[model samples]
Target: MLRFFFVLAVVVPWTVGQPVDLEREIREAFNLGGFPSLAVAVVVGDDSPVMEVHGWADRAAGQRATRATQYRIGGLSKVFTATLLVQLRDEGRLGLDDPVSKFLPEGVKLPADPRGARYITLRHLATHSSGLPRNPVSRTERESDPWNGYSVQRLYEGLARTKLAFPTGASGRYSNLGVGLLGHALGRSLDMPFEDALRRKLLAPLGMSSTRIAMSPAQLKSVATPYARQDPSKIVRAWDYGCLAGCGGITSNLPDLRRFVSLNLRAGLSGVEPVRGASLTELHTPQRIWDGWSKATGLVWIVDHTRDAGDIVWHSGGSQGFASWLGFSPRWKIGVIVLTNCGRPVDDVGNRLLRQALKKYRKLSPKFRAMAERLVPHLVATPGDKVKGLFHEDFLKDVPFSVLKNVLSGLAKKHGACSRVLRVDPADRPELANVVFQFADLSLVTGKMGVSEGDPAKIVYLRFGR
Candidate 1:
């Protein structure tokens, strides 16, 4: 694909008075996905959340997906489990740095590092840095019904023979077993089942009565039927996490998840018990660096940074028959939740919606708008030398002017002259800017530029995308 400058003429509207409609975009995504059903909830700042559902909850039964349709949130359950641990830490009941050995059930123990002694803490478990594997048993043993038959005793037996993939905290790897163990230990400490503790400490307080590991008969009726990913006509049974419920065993709906996202954005202002600002901060803060700092893991939250939206705290989950994505920009106070009844990932759809939300909610200052206006002429019509002088020496060294001019020429040849500026998003730093432009052909293109630190008007970085 052309990486430098791309066109979005077919995807985004350049016409004035036509605002970007996220519902239409989401519906288009659902159609492209061809899943059994999809539900989405979006919140921009303090505005009332917008909920939309498409397709069927149970295709065979001819039941359409609704606002109330519940779907398994898969690995998102880890966030709730991790939050409970933080709450316990805040209450002086336990410490994040405490060894897992201190809380494990009386007769159960995590496999030790035979090479040398290494203490794995609850923090390690929460962050998936405990050196444990992704699962306790092999794929052959579990088959289609992975967690159903796995009991506490079986988990203990498996742990006895398990080996650490690496020393604790040396590196990070995703492990469902690690978080499940954390949940088990927390339950043991609370002298109750993990589900009960979670309800009493978090769910009930948030009025999330519909979110649970095992739904009641009435709640079950509202659940969107699980379907095989490869063959939607084939039904798949709901997962029962038995002892590993903390890792991926919660079924929730759009309304409940919207409330959850709102609470996270209003971390300090919830006025609810156990949902303190401090704990929420700890849950979102990066504990381990990955992919060269652009992404990191925090408790159970995945923190990712983008030039378009700044920092986003998000998580995606997938089980045998369900997929979900939940993401929020705390700085922007925007959140998006996507759920589907099939196992195909909805992350791409969720991410696209989030970008749209950021663009809609973001207000450009007069100065930033002027900067965008100043650059449009040169970006759209100027030749190589005119555009070259606009960039910093450092930028030209990385992306040669020849490469830059070729992309611009290609764009002009295809789209004709530029017409107007549609949007301008100024970065947290004053010198950086992102602008969306409408061409004479009414095509849309996004262009980003950053000035040199020493000279605020000369570009040091630039990118253009669809």
Candidate 2:
């Protein structure tokens, strides 16, 4: 099988002149969906020609989110921690197969009682196959520290008491506990604190000034306040990871993140002299294969593909009050980063624009390009009255019939064909409808074509076009 840089060309385009305004679309997406603000940075390998900002950083103060605005990048922090381990292996400081026992305190070692512990290697942790629990440290999160105060001391304490759920190296399971332990152990191996080790080993060299597990005093002033989008009108508190900063505790702005994406997309071919292409390949390759799922885990990068898009290396993060996503297709050398203050799901947000943008770049061809140009501008200009709250929040939220009538009127106005999705007994679920929407010849955009729940939750297309 090929090891590095699989070529992935855009296979479809959703439209012609699909809303080319990313900045406006980003802001509108957040605002319409009740998000406070967001920041985005896009790059075409090493050169970041597409950086933009939208909305407020602090909703209360109305501070605008910008390219330099600092944001809490939740689970996206895992990718950074994973990359450090790969670098250590490259530098002879660690081995991919090293056991957790090699670097941790003796008492914390996997006991002889757990037959599977012995087989767990650094690869297991990186691949999430150590049989560790999700938020094993969640004990702390459930109790006093919403951030899960699993400090260095508590980490060692927990490890000392840790036991295996199953044999190590047998399979992969996504676990915050596994990656968090890796971060802490690497610090111990380096004889430095996790914060210092990450900075000295990765950040400084990569020139990522704003990327850090813990923010500096100067950064604190600029950091965006986190929020949750739940309505009833109130402020949501920030999340705490206690000491498990490796799981998701970093704060960074889009500028610094652009560097990470650029580096990954080019396969670390940074300067004129490419960095070891081998390590980059290892970072993007899957350490384990689960079930029949083709997704691969390379350190922190998740290599996933869709029939329409291919080999996208990506990760998304969500904490108490923030959500973020980073994805790039190395084949095309293009990447996008989305950081939002409100803890709204980012995958849906990122993918919505991802395909649309790729098509506009000519990455996709004539037949499949979306026909959104003639109608989208007018819709963007009008009030959200027709589609207001009509766009399904999840595959679950119900939309009003009035919204549909409005959309039918819209298609007529645009002199285009209007279509409504009517699902049969076993069909109307969100999972199937979303895939069918792009092919539906409707003047308005919708997330899905059917409903699953009842009444307030029975989600229809939840869209209006006219």
Worst 10 residues of 1 by lDDT: 1-10
Give model 1's TM-score versus the native structure.
0.76
Per-residue lDDT over 405-463 for candidate 2, one digit per residue giving the tens place of the 0 to 100 score:
45434444443342432211111221222221222244324332233344433233322
TM-score of 2: 0.70
Please report, in order, the local distance difference test score of every candidate based on alpha carbons. Answer: 0.79, 0.63
Relative to the true structure, candidate 1 has a C-alpha RMSD (angstroms) of 8.1
Task: Tell me the lDDT of candidate 2.
Answer: 0.63
True-vs-predicted CA distance for residue 395, candidate 2, Å: 49
